[model samples]
Target: MTAITGALAMAVAMGLGRFFYTPVLPAMMTGLGLGPAEAGWIASANYVGYLLGAVLAAYGWAEGIERKVAISGLVATALLLLAMGVSSNVLVLAIIRFLAGLASAFVMVFTSAIVLSHGLAASKPWVQSSHFGGVGAGITISAAMFGLIILADSGWRTAWIMAAVLAFAGLAVVMRYLPRDIVRTGPARKEPPLAWTPSLAALTIAYGIFGFGYIVTATFLVAIVRVGGGSSLFEAGVWLATGIAAAPSVAYWMPAVRRVGHANVFALGCLVEAIGVAASVLVPLPAGPVIGGILLGGTFIMVTAFGLQLGRQLANESPRRALALMTAAFGTGQILGPVVAGYLADWSGSYTWASLAAAAGLLASGAIVLIYCRPRAA
Candidate 1:
């Protein structure tokens, strides 16, 4: 019961915070009078905030700070979104989005580290992964609301406001239920009296690539499909839901992480991601979108889960630095992904090149995982 409670709290914190962005963007543009460039910049600004917030929560405040970080982050994110309701300037909106993004990142880093190190202990991969399944659940909620709610003529801003209301309500729930005594561990033991080995470096670099590749699809997949004989926003919504359905790989990979190790799980997930991306271009149909989204989402979360698992393993149970590196690498990729996709979309007026780039990045991540990370017994 305690574990389930913890997972749900963390899930709401991470899932609700991160999953509602894209759906709300269209409305924001239409009603809020945001230009395309502005919308994109705001999205990217959020990513930047995430990068900074991740850095702070992952390392600088690893001890006695988890609950404070989580609580404060959730509250701040709610406020930032709520504030956008009255803010007039694009500059103010961007700043608020960035801060919201950062708050989400802080909660994510803290909650994820807790789940990985404490909630699931060192033996329960399935538990941790299932917790990640909350992301998909949260996305489903956002998608459903975005689709059903005919908010005011105000467009995306209204949706953002609604999302803010929902998230704030969630924040209240988390505050009421979240545990307080998160035992902060000391400096992690070293695998061989060294923390920054070449393998770790390789893993970090590969994950950076993973971030870049995954975002290309995640940020633009719906648009890409719409371009290539795609269907309505309804169809895109279905595809997104399918992608969410695939988010439980964290649980699926848990046993493998215990039996095989983090490296193999990470490598395997990346390899699958590469396959999914390639398949996306080749089979850009309804079934194709469904398959690709499921595969891609599953693998992506596995990489995320295993990254933490491996960092914990390599750091001799201390994951502060490795986790920080992983978050930064992935966040950097996410920040660049949309820009690269947009550039490609502009240059070719099609999604072929962007999807190709995504495939290439996934392949690169897989290769790195194979070379540097392999599954080991937990």
Candidate 2:
């Protein structure tokens, strides 16, 4: 039940709250006459808030009240989605996205701590996979909703309204199933500080690079389809493919982790995702975006799961702090990806060069892991 609830929470917070923007971006662009540069600015605003939220979560301030913090995030997410629906001004939208990003980060940190800790205590590692699967599930749901809105000839505003309703429904499930008093009611104990090591530093760098590599396509895949003259339905289908591939990715890669170790698997996933990112702009329309979307969906989530798991292992004495540090690195990369990609798209009139650069970053990320973080033989 805890695992299921956690998945629902993630679906609401991450799938809808954060990533739903990707699917909705094209419609917003069409309706609002937004250029890539403006879109990038809005996306970067969210990432900025995410970076701040990660830093805050790293502190001990919210330790014992993680559940409450998570719930607050959910509430804020739902409201912000509604707020998005009502706003047309670029600055207002950016502010709302920024607040929403902050809320999503809070949900991510607290909910993962709750769910992963429970999974570890229960000796059921599958719980971790199921919990993360919520993100893919949520993405799938949003894609479906977007398709329905497209069928109705509704705009992005309607999509946001529907998203708010969905988030509220997920929030209700989490409130009912997730225990009210999961954490002890008292002052939180202080955790030992995370020790900086060469391996850990390399992993952090790799994780940040992975963030920059994946986000370019993640942010603009639907828009890219539009540029290729694909119908709205086809665009939604491509996103749906991504969600479908993502749903079971963590579970699918768990066996690989046992065989190759986390860092190696992480490296391999980066290589695979780099192929997908390159495909997005290199290959011709339809097939190219579809294949790229699949690869993106299939690897990004698994890599994310492994990266955080490796961070926890490396910072055994301070998992939460390590997660915060890694998340901050990732957020920093995320902030740069869209701005760079957006302006490049506006200038070059295509995503080819920007995407190729991102793929290079992924390749470098993989190399870093293989060189510096690979586990030694016993």
Candidate 3:
């Protein structure tokens, strides 16, 4: 029951609250006369909210009232989506998105803590990773909604309205099933000396780079494909492809990570993601977006899971603090990506430079992780 609810909560928090924007972007642009720069600004606003939310989570404020806050966040997110449909003001949209980001962060942090801690105590660590499948499920469902809107020739406002409805449905399920009491598996081992080893520092930086590295593509891929000669069907198809690839990624990769070790798998995932990012620019027509979507979807969530798990191992003494720092770094990187990419696209009249730059960041991130986190010679 906990696992089921955990995945559903994630779908609502991340897939709907965060990523539904990807499929909705082109529609909003066409309907609202929003340019790449304005769209980027709106995206950045959400990310900034995410950063703020991460900070709050890190500080452990609202610990006792987590359930109330998490439920409120989900409700707020649904209302915000409905609000987006009612307004065309860019500033208003930005504010709504920012608030939605806060809601999403609360749900993610609180629900994961409740779900994973309970699962761990029950000797079901695998259920913890399966919880992320909710993200992919949410994305796929959102894409399907967007596809239907396109087929009906409905405008962006209608899309937002429908999405809000879906969010409410999800919220209802979550409210009914999410565990009220989370059982942590006691304390996490004796406190290890809090030391900043080179590897730890490198992993932290690499994690940030990964955040910046992926956000550009993740935010703009549908838009880019639309401009690059894709039909509405093709545009929706790519996003659905992304969700499909993402859904099973953690399960598929966890065993491999266990065998090869977290550092190697983390490095490899980054490198693969870099290739995917570059492919979006280098390949022509639909091939680039299609193949790129698969690769990006396949790795991003896995890399996140891997990085956070690795952080827990490193900060054995204070896993929450370590995870918080990593989340902060990631949120900071994400806040910058869309703003820069959006303006760069506006100035250059293309996304080529932005995609290339993001790919390079990913490559550099991979190198740092490989070199610094590599196992020392025996």
Candidate 4:
């Protein structure tokens, strides 16, 4: 029950809050007459909010205000999603997305922290990694829901309404299962700020590279497929495949990491994802996106889970601060990815160069991790 509940929270906050935007992007472009640049800017707005929320969480604001903000974020996000159904103004949409991004980050960081403390007390640390599958599950459910809406001939507005309904359902589960009393792992250890460690600085920069590498395809894959003349069902199926592949990635990769070491496995996942990201544009038709989605979905969460674990290992005194630093690095890259890709695509009349550039970034990051982040000899 605890694991299920944690997964549901992530499904709502990260999956629905963050990713539902991917499938819905094409609809909005068609319905709202939004250009690629406009859509990219809106997406970047969300990342900005995410960075702010994560910084607040890291600074210990979450320790006292988390419960209030958690509930408020869930409720507010639901209403904001519903509001999206009624508003077509670009400014309004951007504001709502930004706030929703902020709320989602709060739910993700604080709830995970809360759950981790409980899991630690219960001696069930594995639950921390396992619950991340919720992001994939949420992605699957949202993709299916959007697919059904399109099948019913509904527009972008109805899709937003469906997403809101799904968020509300998840909210009920969260309110019921999330621990009301905050659980403390132990006395907080004092450590220097995250910027002090050379190794951590490298890790932080690598994480940002990953964020840049993946965001382009993650944001625009559906649109790329649509422009390539794929059917709506095909596009949804690609996204669904990504979620399904993602759902079990951590389970599979964790064992590998245990054997080979975190740095090696992490770097390998980056290479795999780079190939997948490039495939979206390099290959053809349903085959391209489908293959790309599988690779993209399967490895991203593994990289994230491993990266955070590595951060905690490095900055044992204050894992939360490490997380904040990582989020800031990652969010900054994400902020840049879409906007740059959008402009590049607009200029080139193709996503080819942009996709290749993202892949190159991932490869470079993998190299950095291999050289700088490798685990020391026992």
Candidate 5:
């Protein structure tokens, strides 16, 4: 029950709150006459809020009230979605996205703390995978909703309203099923501090690189398809493909992790995702986006899970802090990716060069992880 609830929470927070923007972006652009640069700024604003939220979550302030925090974030996310629906101004949208990003990070950090801790206590590690899968599930739902809206000839504003309703529904389920006992209301127990190491540092940097590399495609894939003259249905289908691939990625990659260890699996995922990112723009129409979305959906979340898991192992006693550090690094890269890609797209009139550069970053990220964080012999 906890695992299912956790997945629902993630679907609401990440899939709808964070990424619904991608599918809706094309419509917003068409309706609002937004250039790529403006879109990039709005995306960056959300990442900036995410960064700040990560930093805040690192402080152990929510030690006994993680559930409260997570619930608050969900509420904020739903409200922000509605706020987005009512606003057409660029600055207002950016501000709303920024707040939404903050809410998302809070939900992510707190929910993971809740679900992963429960999984550990129950000796059911698969719970973590289920929790992560919520992201893909949410994305699938968003894509379907947007596709329906497009077919109905409804505008982006309606899409945002629909997102808000979906979020509220998820919130209700989460509130009902997410265990209240997980909250530790007694005095906080002391844990060992995180011991920073060279390998940890390298992993952090690589994680950031992965963030930059993947985000370009994640943010703009739908737009790219639209620009390539694909119909609205095709664009939604591509995004749907991505979500479907993402749904089981963690389970699919677990075997590889056992065989090659976390760092190796992380490195390999990066390489695979890099190919997808480059292919999104470099390859031609239908095949390009389809292959790109599948590979990307197949790898990004798996890599994300491994990266956080590795960070937790390296931190020893301070798993939350480690998670926060990794999130901060990722947020930094995310903040840069869309803005850079957006401006580059505006300047070049295509996403090719920006995407290639992002792919290069992913390659470098893989190399760094493989070289610096390789597993020691048993």
Candidate 6:
């Protein structure tokens, strides 16, 4: 039942609320006649709201906001995705997306705490990884839906309605099933306890840089390919396939990291991720995007999975504050990736500059991970 709750919670509260935007955005821009800057601004608004939510939750002001909060957040996000289809005003849509993103941040904090307390254990890396896969699953669903309806010349509203329906169903499951005790891992660690150990701080900074790097490609990879002259189906297919394949890829990636050491494993992930991003800059071909998606899909999720694990391994802080600090670093970087990419694209008149910048950040993160993380004993 707890696993079911985690799965459903992720599908609604964390997954669709956070990830569906990018997959559907291409169809949106085409059907709705939206501009790049406006689209970027909407994405930025989501991140800003996410940032605020993370900071608030990390500071202990977010106590009353747990299981029920997740249900409300998912409900709002589902409705907003539908609302986006009907509303023509960009400002209105941005505000809706911002709130949804904020909702997503809080949901992640709560659900992740649940997992750490019960679901996350050494014997269950693959099982725990599936929960993270929910985000990709949401993206796949949204992208596939958009591809089918878009070819039919159906409006973006159809996609939003679908997202809403999915969310409402997930919410019903959460209400019926999620455990009520909410205290993850015995009594919670004392409030205001120290959160940033040397290892934890390195972990946090590395997580932030990873966030900065990954979002640039995830947010804009399809758009860049579209601009570079790839067909719509090509972009959509790669996106969906990445989301679908990512669940299993963690099995391959995390163990390799565990054996090779976290620092080197993380470096390899960054290296591969950078290669994919760099390809997006040059190839503009179907092969380039597909390969990029495979690599990106495989490792990014592992980085996240391990970041949380690594922090917990090293820290003596509350699950709430420790996870929040690590994730807040991640979320902060994610929030910036798109807006910065947008500005670079706007000024340079090409997506290459933005992508290259993202690639550089990934390498930089690799350096941080290698330097700061102590090598495990062989």
| RMSD, one per candidate, in order | 3.6, 1.6, 2.4, 1.7, 1.5, 2.5
Candidate 6 segments whose C-alpha is farther than 4 A from its true place: 61-65, 120-125, 183-189, 376-378
Please list the residue runs of candidate 1 whose C-alpha ends up more than 4 Å from where it truly belongs after superposition.
9-11, 27-39, 83-90, 120-125, 150-154, 184-194, 228-236, 375-378
TM-score of 2: 0.97
Q: Rate the local accuracy (lDDT) of all candidates.
A: 0.66, 0.90, 0.84, 0.84, 0.91, 0.73
TM-score of each: 0.85, 0.97, 0.95, 0.96, 0.97, 0.91
| Collision count of model 1 | 12
lDDT of 2 by residue, 87-158 (tens): 999999999999998999899999998888778877899999999999999999999989999999898899
lDDT of 4 by residue, 1-378 (tens): 777877888888888888889999988998899888899999888888887787777776456566677777788778888988999899989898899888988887777777776778889867876688888888899998988988998988999898999999999988988777457646544335655477778888999999899889989989889888998888888898988998778888878887988888889999999999989999998788888899999998888878887877777777888987788888888889999999998899878888899999999888888888785410
lDDT of 6 by residue, 165-252 (tens): 8888778877787666454435634466754666667768988999899888888877877887877777778778777766555566
* TM-score of candidate 3 on Cα atoms, chains taken together: 0.95
Instruction: Supply candidate 6's per-residue lDDT for 12.
Output: 75
Comparing 1 with 5 on TM-score, the higher-scoring candidate is 5
Question: Per-residue lDDT for 1-378 in model 1, tens only?
Answer: 334544555445555565565555544555666654455576677778888877665555446667777778888877776787667687887788788778878777776656555654546545576566666656666666666564323355565677678777777766776666454445532223336767777877887888888766665555445545654464437545644665566776678767777777777787788777766666857666556666777777668767766766766544666777678888898788767766776677665777788888888887887776653324
In candidate 6 the C-alpha lDDT for residue 70 amounts to 64
* Candidate closer to the true structure by lDDT (higher is better), 2 or 5: 5
lDDT over C-alpha atoms for residue 338 of model 2: 94
Which is superior by lDDT, 1 or 4? 4
What lDDT does model 5 reach?
0.91
Residue-by-residue lDDT tens digits, candidate 3, 149-262: 889988888988998999999999989998885564463233334467676788889989988999999999999898898998888999999999988888888887878887
Where does model 4 exceed 4 Å of error?
Answer: 185-195, 376-378
